[model samples]
Target: MEHRISKQMIRKIPYFEKMLSHECLESKENKVVLDFDEQAFKIILDWVERDYTIILIEMDYAFDLYELADYLGLDGISKECITYFHKFTIEHLPIIIPKMAKTTKFMTSGALDAFICRHFLDIASSFSKVNRNTKKTFWSKFPIETIEYICALDLMINSEYQVFDAIMDWVLSDSYLRKCHLERLWKLVRWCHLNDKDSSNLVNHLRISAGFEAKLCSPRKADCDCVFNRAKQNCFVMIETLDIKDLRVKVLDNNFKLLVSQVIKEDTSIASNFFHDEHVSDILFDSGRRVIRIDWKQNKYNWAPPLESYAGLQRRIARSVEYGGELYEELELGEDIANGFLLLESTETFDLICFEGKHLHRFSMPIHEIYKRFTTLNNCEATLLNNKIYLLSNKAILYEAHYFL
Candidate 1:
């Protein structure tokens, strides 16, 4: 009994209607028939039924079928087909490459050359892993022109250190390929060091190239500690203008006093005394403005300002801090601070009072709002989060809660 596919079922198969068209199915009498086994025919039928799914074809079939399908121009396939075929082309290289090279006259222009080079590189890489048998096989089949092409392609496309090592091995084995590979390698090295400064490995590879001795040196010896140190130093210098010590000192001198004073106002006297040293600038105060004299050191009672005095000085400071005690009742009712000035939790909202220096001012919005407005208007980010609001600008000023009332 013969297995029969109904016309209706065949019609339901994707691409079957197109295949059944006279232009596709009709065979010319004079045309030579390409032999395909029963399994190959089944694969073709599956390819047709699947509506030429690129991923499926790539995963399921051999490279030759994939190439044929790609050449046939099934919609939504190109790069993936090339990439998939690339793997199989590498795997069955020994059989495929020599055939193509012998029949180069019949092959498409540059196709044989590309196949030869790609397989030569693959075989060379394989030889590096196995014994002399593999090495002899690779050497016997490898063409001089193909070796040079592999070296060129390796330099052009291979970014990984391991791949580079394999290519370099092939390069150093032959004098002609070595010189050509070196020329390409030099260009790649210079491009990596000068243009792509982020490629630390490439820079390291360049250093390896300088000291590499093909006969005696192990490939792993390419990782020279001294070269890495030099590359790291060069990388550091390229990106960082200031020394680490200078950066630390500047950052500490800029934000340290402000952070300390904001967190601990009771310890303000210590910071104040520290700031009096000629080298230390009063960062808390506006630059070029005379420091206000507060007799906190002399009077024990004056260590903390009265709430009434704080209220009086609210307008002098740019921002005010709210003690947990003052907002405890409001917070308990569920209100969140917003825009630096407004506090909204559940149903209640209120504007905050911000103070700059001795002046107290009622802000229509929160400190965050004022900061956003200032940043938007000036096109800059200018909020320092500490115990107090530290206004970072041409003239830095620390706004304390006591000053804001």
Candidate 2:
């Protein structure tokens, strides 16, 4: 049967091209019966006719309206329906994201679903600590894309353990759909942060791992500070550096202006020659412990390799505490770093320094970790004060210096 609509209206969607079919052309009624919801079609018809007000009036029925638009080849209306859903998600998505994810209705690869998921994913980090309800959504028909995105965030998770828990929940929820995503998601977890205690816990979960390649992945060294970092309530990242060569330890404010210039009579003799051909790695000043271990990375002899080689030499090593630059004890290190940068009973952990004001490493992780691509920054001078590492990176062309969080 022929449709009463004009050629212009039918041309908008290819689905209506069926009007030119042999049976349709031969029919005398000049009419067609569509196998779609009449209620949804009426709303779409209004939009097609530029009755845009019907969208707001029938906004609550957006899922159905969008379905009808998609089925009937009404992309214009479908797009508008996506815009309408923005407010819905921003206003209501947090509480319902997981619940809705499980449904085949709007959450199953449709324009509306994509739009909502994208918006939610963008602000996922801003989610106030994951609660019981939000956690439920993790195991629901959560979008695999959202799962991957969350895994990649630098600040989204409070605990890698919780993330592992979520994965376990997700895999158990409906293994058929999510099993394929296991290994792909597993690599994103920062395993090295967990100590032997926590790393051992992951052993059971690794059994079902579907996608990890043995040779392609390696965990970080035992010294990674991820576990300790998770314990911090708030990080005070504002501080200045101390000129190691000078007798006085200089303290700078956030703007890098010299705030306090005071002399520390720690036997300059030992610290003086120490800075000549050496790079200060870390300065541990626990006055409470009455000892300062000035760490430096240098060309130390390692006879383990072929007669003239240093292959297995421990590159990152620290010395014992000293009194007034004079030694109190000999060099000490088995696996030197403990609890990462927050040293033993560390009241003040200072490791940052500026050599001639041109080079520095701020918040530097281990060099071995850097080589393994486990850390983005290789090595830089750092000092810890109150469990906070004051890292320095010189910008000679810019201002003298500045403290930034």
Could you say which candidate leads in lDDT? 2
**Model 2: which ten-residue window has the lowest total lDDT?**
316-325
lDDT of 1 by residue, 267-333 (tens): 2443322112222222211211212322223311112222222222221111232221121111111
Candidate 2, residue 25: lDDT: 50
Tens digits of per-residue lDDT for model 2 on 1-405?
A: 222555456545556665554456523455557766567766556555663344542444676677777777767778877665533322233333443444433343232343332222223212122231232332244566556654444432345565666666667568777787777777656676556676665765476355444222233545533443332222222212335332434546445666645444323334321112122212323311222323223211111111001111111011111110111112222222211221122121112222222333232211223223222222333344443434432321222223232
Model 2 regions more than 4 Å off: 1-46, 49-53, 56-83, 90-139, 208-405
Residue 356 displacement in candidate 1 (angstroms): 50
For every model in order, what is the number of clashing pairs? 30, 15
For each candidate, give its TM-score against the true structure.
0.23, 0.31
